[model samples]
Target: MYQADIAIVGAGMVGLALARSLKEADLSVILIDTTPIAKPLSEQPELRVSAFNAANKQVLEQLGVWQHLDQQRLSAYTQMQVWDQDSFGRIQFSSEEMGTSELGHIIENQSLVNALHHQVSQQPNVQMLPSTRIAKVLAGQSETMLMLDSDEVVSCRLLVGADGANSAIRKYANFPLTFKDYGHTAIVATIKTAAPHGKVARQVFTPTGPLALLPLSDPNLCSIVWSQNSQQADELLALSNSDFAKALQVAIEGDVGEIGVESARMHFPLTMRYARQWLSDGLVIIGDAAHTIHPLAGQGANLGLQDAFALADSLQKLAAEQAAFHQARQLRAFERARKSEAVKMIAAMESFKQLFGGSHPLKKLIRGVGMCTADAIPVIKQRFITQAMGW
Candidate 1:
């Protein structure tokens, strides 16, 4: 059997980031995934993208992976506008207020993954096994043996589950998960606008749900996440491209002008998942394997990146102190800290969703007053800026 200090399952963004972060720990790492990672780079923007805050960007920088990302594909927005539909509640902010160049960047998921996979591949201490998955996980006191489909067996001192929402590692380890069905289906697609986005990220809260128009590198292009209840989503998805564009034009109230579908529409149900236990005997989970939050605030990926960063830092310190990888106390502490952050984010999303979910007059009035108040007050605005920028 092949022997290593650590084995990480799932070579997606989060998994690759974790492997890259551990490059300097002088520990042998084997990264495994069923899918081939870091596929050929694409010049065209992808349908799935993520907004990265400063803190997460810093994490990538520290891992020496940020410099590898393509500059042309990165879209930086200096402004943001959020408002309630058909109400006097509208709020807008700019980078100038915070004395920053940008609030954040929107990058295609594949773009970032390619960059990270490139960096991780260079680390001599890391071995990446793509197109191979763990067929069986044999547990033991000192180590665990991973049986692969190719009949290759590997032993590791610690096992990490970074595999996404339906993580096989998480399931095999018997980690309990607490989840909530948001009853929202999100339609995502690439869109072209008649009006230039002007480097602004905009979101509108409608009676049915929320719609976010995320600016892309091209001034006239954007990636949209239009979330609505199941019934509404079904109707919207059934409409023809032309009809849907008309419907989108009305829903957006012409904020970005005419809407043209530039890519195929794809969607998935929204759900919040939190693993009741992130640490198991001889195993631990991170990223989506640990928890998943609502995308309304765009904190899901940022949160997962943070988890990998923190765990890496913890592992480095532990190694410096000559501590065992499976020491109960140290592992537990790491788990607690990351879990707390996830809980806070989950609570914030639920509260925000409920607060703007309905058309109740009283709630609308409260939202209008609150948003306007936050916009008008520098202190309150600063608080929001701090959160959005991940300061």
Candidate 2:
């Protein structure tokens, strides 16, 4: 049987980041994932992407993984504009107004994953097993054993499931989950705009859903995330490239002048999920396994990175105390910290969705009044900036 201080299931962003953070602390870590990580240098640009909040970027920088990324391919958004279709009112937020340099950055998902994997490989205490599956997980009060598909077994003091929303590891633990299906689907892609993005991220709310244009490295390029009803999403995806672009134009109401298709569109159903328990015995769930929120705020990945940070901090504290690697107290602390943040984020997203998604006259009045109220309250604006930056 292989042995390590910790065993992580899933080598995606959250798992890799967690391994990198803990490996340098004199702890043995084994990261297992079914999909072999690909080399980022060989992939074409404008593929799957994610918005990295400021706090998450700091975490990557501290892990020394961010430095390995191609800076030229990133886009920093210094400003944002959010508006609704029912009214001609819009709210604009700028970094300058908040006394900051940037709100966040947009980067390709593969780039971030590749950089994290590269860093993990260099850590002496980290062993990465790619294209491997875990057949069984056995958790005890002080340790866990992971049975692999090949009949190989690995033992660790603690087990972490960085696996995504449909996490098998989480299921094994029987963590109760609260699930809400919005009956909406998000269509994502990249596009070329006739007008420059000007370092701004724009989100327009329509009756169907929210449409967002996030700035990319290229001035004329923008990342599109259009959330609509199931039927609307199906119709949009069924259209040809030209027709889809036309529909996108109408959705954003020509925010960036003429828009052209630059990447193939992909759609995914929307969901808001929260696991009642992130830890049981010697196992814990992080990232999407613990909580999955809507993409409206672009905080899903950022929150997952924060989970890694909190877990690493807890582990370091336990190590300093000379406690066992899988101390229940330490794991519990990690879960509490992460769950508190997740609860707040989940509530915020749900509130936003309900307030703007309704067609009632009172809701419209509240929407208009809320924008004005936000503009008038400088403190509220600053608070928003701080939250957006994950401060």
Note the clash tally of each candidate: 0, 0
Local accuracy of candidate 1 as per-residue lDDT tens digits, 1-391: 7788889999999989888999899788999989999887556679999999988888788788888888888999999999999899989989999898999999888889999999999999899999997889999988999999899998998898999999998899788889999999999998999999999999999998999999999999999999899899999999999998998888889888988998889999999999998886678899999898878988898999889888888888887888887555668889999999999999999999999998999999999999999999999999998898788
On the 0 to 100 scale, the lDDT of residue 197 in model 1 is 98
The segments of candidate 2 whose C-alpha lies over 4 angstroms from its true place after superposition are 41-46
lDDT of 2 by residue, 146-201 (tens): 99998999999888899999999989988999999988899998899999999999
Root-mean-square deviation of Cα positions for candidate 2 versus the true structure, in angstroms: 1.6
Looking at model 2, residue 210 earns an lDDT score of 88
Candidate 2 worst ten-residue window by lDDT: 38-47
Cα RMSD for candidates in order: 1.0, 1.6
